[model samples]
Target: MKEYNTVFPNLIDDRYFFQDISIDKLPIMDKYNGMINVSAYTDAAEYINAQDVTFYGAWLLNMLEERLIALENYLVYDVEKPELVSYTNTEPTGVPVGYCWT
Candidate 1:
């Protein structure tokens, strides 16, 4: 069950093996009939898929159940509270020495 469209980026599943984006297909043929063996493309789609899961609305409900359980274990510990720092929000800070230092 495969479909082609302009927005394939918006329709990828993460839990299954995607042969098209696997290590065997790492090398791609360019427009000039040249083979480019790029390492990043091999797993790039998987990383992007993970990012999508992280940012998807209520996606945490699907993924964070384990993390929530792990966090619950720490609830029993009486950790010391860290000091809260305050700062003025009038402008953006951390400008470089010369580039857009205004």
Candidate 2:
């Protein structure tokens, strides 16, 4: 018979207590120029007071702005009234082009 190790998601280790570890082991934070003392009680208050950060120069914002302009153009100018668009031999249903409402 072969032996195998079993893994479970919510298992807790018995050897190490969380309070036994010091905060100095944490990597230096560029934002604060120091390692964070990750006490749940203290950090929760600090996080509440911290200002929101946004990536204003992100590419997705520019792409979304462009999409908004294209959508505005599509809704305002590119749309043809159903009666104006000449689909060969098909009668206009009077709804806007591409909206197939009965």
Candidate 3:
């Protein structure tokens, strides 16, 4: 019997720094007579304010930007080298491997 050890790094740990907001606490709109009232919008504003949605949203955006920058910096690939080489067909009846119709 053999045992393997594996470790995975957390990428979005900062996302969990903020407490989770409940969906039930969010505002619910009323659609009476096929129209929504201004009170629904006001309730939504209140909900947003109470949950600090804007602040967390901005934080998430910043985190995403940082992660993207890190990924771009970490990637090191040779642009001069061909990634895929086309295989020539030697058989008379079959299509060649890595052949493109266009």
Candidate 4:
């Protein structure tokens, strides 16, 4: 199902994905082109979607594009096999043939 006007820092299923702010959980800033309305904290629609909301907000769209690229390349861990058995426990820990726990 398609959810409308939703946003999250990371997937809810992630073990370490922490929810930042309640305001961030909703698409309140989306109406303002993803600007943080410090003045009008109640109604997001009250905030104008101007580019010059702030020096950072002014370039938010550009920043977001860059951020998405970084996120796409984010690595929780090495996808390929890692060297885990460093002489301490070289025996197989029941992992896949080429997998190791770090």
Candidate 5:
């Protein structure tokens, strides 16, 4: 068996930096009948508010942007790098064509 080791600076290690939030019994009325029901309810989102952060957080964001740019470049790759050749095939009788059409 073989093992690989990876190391990085002891930076931010908290994955779930934001807390989970739940909004129950949210108002969701039917547009046609104007009737409210439990089936018509919606959910509020739990998101990270990055208003306050350290320099490490900003540096992580910059690294993410660079990675996204690299991914975009890989997606829009052009396979055809050469120009097509042009040709002419005609007879001296001014018939204007030859085996090029066949």
Candidate 6:
């Protein structure tokens, strides 16, 4: 996997991503059923630069596409080789069958 710094060089030393802020400390409230509100804390422009966002978005899309292709290949392998599938019994004594891809 690529390091965070390698993917986002400009954000390497940025505190927003690295800082461990507790979610409980945030100004959040359940106003209604399935509805919530939270306060904004950072400068939007600093966090959402067009160039950086675009680059990261494209990179994320590419990574997701690659993963999807890999998963498709694995599924195809399972379909092609039914004899290779096996089952294992867990502590509860339930058998779950699955393909073991190397």
The model with the greatest TM-score is 3
lDDT of 2 at 74: 66
> Pairs clashing in candidate 1?
none
lDDT of 6 by residue, 1-102 (tens): 222232222233222232343455232221211231233323322333322222233445555565566557657764565454444453323334664433
- Clashing pairs for predicted structure model 4, backbone only: none
Scored against the true structure, residue 26 in model 1 reaches a CA lDDT of 36
The per-model lDDT (C-alpha) reads: 0.36, 0.39, 0.41, 0.41, 0.31, 0.37
Clashes of each: 0, 0, 0, 0, 0, 0
Which scores better on lDDT, 4 or 6? 4
The alpha-carbon lDDT assigned to residue 28 of candidate 4 equals 40
Q: lDDT by residue for model 1 over 1-102, one digit each (tens)?
A: 111122212343334222333333333222112311355642544443433122222343534454444445446453554434334455446544443312
Give the lDDT of residue 17 in candidate 3. Answer: 45
RMSD of 3: 13.7
Model 4 residue runs over 4 Å out of place are 1-58, 76-93, 96-102
> What is the RMSD, in Å, between candidate 4 and the native fold over all Cα?
13.5
* Model 5 worst lDDT run, 10 consecutive residues: 41-50
The sequence of per-residue lDDT tens digits that candidate 3 reaches over residues 1-102 is: 111111213343333344544465333222221233445654544544454333344445655666666555545432243334344555334446654433
Task: Write out the backbone clash pairs for model 3.
Answer: none
Candidate 6 RMSD to the real structure: 14.6
Query: Which regions of candidate 5 fall more than 4 Å away from where they truly are?
Result: 1-56, 78-102
Residue-wise lDDT of candidate 2 within 1-102, one digit each (tens)?
Answer: 111222212242122122332345333223322223444534533533352322122333554555566567667776674544454566555566555532
**Candidate 5 has what TM-score?**
0.23
Give the C-alpha miss distance for residue 12 in model 4, angstroms: 21
lDDT for predicted candidate 3 compared with the true structure = 0.41
- Where model 1 places Cα greater than 4 Å from the true spot, the runs are 1-59, 77-102
